[model samples]
Target chain A: MSTRWYPIYQRGNPQLRVFLPNFWMKLVRPTEEQPPNVVTFAVSTEMTKHDVKNYLEKIYKVPVVEVRTRIALGDTKRDQTYGYITKNDDVKIAYVTMPKTEAFKFPDLFEKKAEQLEKDEKSMDDSKEGFRKFLERNKKRPGTPGWFSI
Target chain B: MSSTLMKCLSLANTLRTATLRSLLTSQQKPTLAPWGAVVPALASHVQAVSGIHTSAASLGLMEFFDDPKVWSENEVKVGRAWKPDELRIKSNKELHQLWYILLKERNMLLTMEHECNDKMEVFPNPERIDKVKISMENLETVVRERNKAYHLLETGETGERPQRLVHNCFGLRYMYKSCEHVLPPFMNIKWIKSRNVGFGGRAVRKFLLQYREKLYNEKRKAKNRSRNEVMMILRRNPDFDLEVLRRQFPQVNIDKLRNEDKARGHYVPKIGV
Candidate 1:
């Protein structure tokens, strides 16, 4: 089957199998709180519930019990200065129901980001101090290369 | 008596050699055990130790997420994209597997980027998505090359979708990609009518004329602009290198422009001083 030109399916024909499917599904964090079994995904707008089911089951090896999908319209906003309106692209969101045995939670990736920033700032301050010391030491010898001293 | 003893020894040696040959053959071609299970023979052993080619799928849903180690990093360092030259050497199976790998990486990056945008946080290393996209494009190109070569060898034609240059009703030529239809061209009335459109109408001819004139005007204006620019440069700098000006604007005749009044500097010439 030609992937670029997908022909209409007719009865009594060979079942179509996509050998190299290029569909992409992004596992999105749900805006609203959902059950542990139901994992939300932002998929390609062209994908149906069946495609999402097959994608998760065959590709990710996830046992999907039920799949529900909906296209959420993006919000439109007007520019404050120009008053021109712009709208975001509508996205197909899929809620995949997994077996009760499987449990997952959206991870807090940036929980430690605050501490990381503090550490980075401390290191930056130390580097500033070191540079100031180096400049003071080189006061007597103007236009000397940094490597010539140390 | 000694000859008989030697004959017995030769028979024993042949028997031993025959048994060794049978064992070597069995090791070479692995046999299936009960219930279609492969016997862990030499060939299977080598396959088992050959190392993992694809990523392990045990990560499950976590596969959609980036590695935990780089979750909160400010900048994630990564290698450059897979060049077409690098992808060309890979086997079809390897390229197919790499395509899925890159696809998954792109999905993961997009997921992270979406989450970051939702939370109003910075997504580290956003260019990683572009890298994966480039790799995927290169992979597709390599796969297409192989497919084209195979099709040409077997069918004496590129097995790609057929397209032809056709003129539309607007008198514009474009490549029309043919699509699969149940009815033949002679039978399909709608398609026939659509394809029967000819280009030479009074309005279309006028449009074509104006379009050509517009294109010619653009070209003419560009040449005139460059000529004027060269003249201005010569006027500002009288001793400017003529060879350099000639190289800069190859289309402009530097010698001819030098003789023009516009190319002369404002300063008076010291003649016969």
Candidate 2:
């Protein structure tokens, strides 16, 4: 059966199961600090606390103690130029509590960003230096082709 | 460590071994064609490089994020989506596994996109989502095709949702996809009542009449236009191929129009007895 076509669950009928679930869950950093055991997730709107628990336990094999969920209202702001209001989509957030021993601190993703920028700057400087050296070399022979001499 | 932790460690070890074994087996196999060597080379490179893989972990929190290398990169390159023909060759089990992989990739991309948007940063290579979507769609289509073939073999009719041409309240015809219901159509009073729509009334008749007249006018005008074009062509070029004219303007009678004075060109035709 297609994913969209769901059969009505009667009292005696065999339980319906989803084979290929297309639901997506993203682990996002929480705005407010919480216990290390508690991890936040932005989940599909259709997902429930049970679904979140099953998803992590079965798919990712992460041990979950409890699951708390809330629907966060999307931000709304007025347009600066035009007097119109713009709103973002509502997101369902799931707070999954792992075992007491299991501690998960949101790792700083962009910690090495400064290092990468420095490396990029170094490469840019090298290129600029090489170009300047080429200009210096061609000063004597003004019209000489770049590939003409060593 | 807990028993679950031990199980996870073992699972991770087994997974690593399985991946390595596959890589080795693939590389050892002889290439059928000269171009076939590229797959093994690329596969091995992708499999071996752990540093380049940003979030490769065993049931860890890193599973939700993208590769660190791609996070700062301006562009992320990806191959095209899986074609139906390519997917058709894959076994059901393989397709199922591939589907999950694609699903995870799509989720990762979406999460990254959201984070980027939230940070007011440009999302790199947004087309990656579209690629994954197309792959998932193609995968579903392949599965559906297989299901249809099997259903046709077992059952006489296709195991698909039944639909029929139905008219709406506006008197416009459309295909209505029918679904399974707990009660039969006759027993469902609410459904029956809903189905009974504005199929009558003087307004509908008048609207249909005007609509039909408008349609008829358009058709009539097109016929006249083609007829006039044929007449004009015959009048200008008398020696024009009647066969070609007949093929083009089949609605216009060439023989009848040929005898008309209007069809004759300004230059007199040379008559040989």
The C-alpha TM-scores of every prediction are 0.78, 0.70
Cα lDDT tens digits for candidate 2, A1-150: 454466778799998887677888888878899998999999999999999998888766789999999999999999999979999888899999999999998765556656766877898899999989889999988988879987
lDDT per residue for candidate 1 within B99-131, as digits (tens), equals 666777778789889888877889987887887
Which regions of candidate 2 fall more than 4 Å away from where they truly are? A1-4, A76-87, A128-149, B1-57, B201-273
Candidate 2's residue-wise lDDT over B1-273, tens digit each? 355445544544443344322532353321111112222223333131112222223636666777766576555544456678777876776677667667667777777887777776677778868877887888888888887888899997667777899999878799988877788999999889888877688888889889899999999999989888888999988889999999998889999999887888888678993
Clash pairs (backbone) in predicted model 2: none
* Native contacts kept, each candidate: 0.59, 0.28
TM accuracy, model 2: 0.70
Itemize residue pairs with steric clashes in candidate 1.
none
